[model samples]
Target: MALLETLVVVFAVAVVAALAVVVKTRLFPLREGEEPREDVAEYISMMVSVFYALVLGLCLVSVWDNRATADDRVQTEASALHQTYLLADALPAAQRQPVRDAARAYAAHVVEVEWPRMAEREPLGTEGWALLDRLRTAGELTGRATLSQQIAAQEVLAQLGYVDDARRGRETAAGESLSVVLWTGLIIGGVLTVAFMFLFGLERNTTHVILVMGLSGFIAFTVLLIYQLDAPFGATLGVAPDPFTRYFPL
Candidate 1:
């Protein structure tokens, strides 16, 4: 779903949950002597809050790191392609233009075609691989090439290897996400945390309602943020193709 739609759903759920708590409390009021055991409820709530906080922290760090790694892989791939293009200058006149053209085509395809597919978590077809093969073939030095040209060819091959590795990494990252079990924990934990607030509420109903609303809203916001960050190449809050555009420039 779109980010705004997700947010609306989350907020609606939070509001409904808060309203349910309010209605339940009004229907069954606490007993007069219940103060004696209120501390226990508070302690349990505190523990749950701490545990949930830890889980949220860990999830946030993991998703943020994954996003950063995805961006780095893009930059690495672009740099490798750029290096391969520049190294063509050291190749023989017959071999130089073809390699450069192949490198350009690969970069163009990645930026123009593959990037959009990645946003949708779709596969880039054999065309990109075919372009890489073309670049590799063009960089191959034959019997007539000089020693320097042969060395350049080897260097170009090495850079191509880097590009291939980084491209694979990018593709893997585009499809990466937090597991379903973890998502279950996150959602259930948030609900339980808010529900616990209703167990031992404030003296004033208005104050209690406000507290529940604020806490639930914050939890929903955090969950939404994590969701957005989970898929590094998702359409929302995803890494852009700036690296390719910067290096290749069309």
Candidate 2:
């Protein structure tokens, strides 16, 4: 629902931009004197460009931090999960395989099932979490063994904490209100910048090259910025699901 609302807002902005362009070009034709004196248009464009750069830099910083934090969280979770797995070996023979099997199954379900859905921003189902609970309960450490199990259990619990926090971070990164706004600004600024170009009476031979360069660069930078943030779990640039793979896998 929130995503849908964001889309609607963006669509509305695009519509407004299109209408503004039509009206500006058709009715308020650009003329040397009709615009402000002392190259006011140029000054405004320069200021807006500078501001846009600042905004772009800020967005990069934010996303980079978000990705870095997510990575750290996953690493922490992996460490905790590893401790729990090793502890399984110290359990009584009858309980060791059961504990390890439960952990492995939980890890596999997370990697195979939960991840792809998160990529699409879907809520993780309750079943995987239920499995985690089962893994915790399967310990069956009573009295004397309980102390050893606590050491491992505590670590696994900590890892689970990290995993949950990291998921929230990943989700937060995607739902960044400012990112959508920054993208809106970049796009609108580019259009206004380009449209202002058309208003200039440039020579026929020289205009195309400059126009192509401006549009190409704008499109490339703006697009990839958004794309890089879209997935928090898929590639090297994305959040590492390796926590599960390294410690929990069969």
- lDDT tens per residue, model 2, 91-166: 6566678777877887787678877766665777787768767777766564565566667655655655665565
**Candidate 1 Cα outliers beyond 4 Å, as residue runs:** 1-36, 203-210
- Residue 237: error of model 2 in Å? 4.3
Per-candidate local distance difference test: 0.87, 0.66
Clashes of each: 0, 0
Could you give candidate 1's per-residue lDDT for residues 1-35 as a string of tens digits? 45456667768998998899799779977887765
What is candidate 1's CA lDDT for residue 44?
Answer: 81
What lDDT does candidate 1 reach at residue 8? 77
Model 2 spans with C-alpha error above 4 angstroms: 1-38, 146-179, 206-215, 234-237
Question: Local error of candidate 1 at 229, Å?
Answer: 0.9
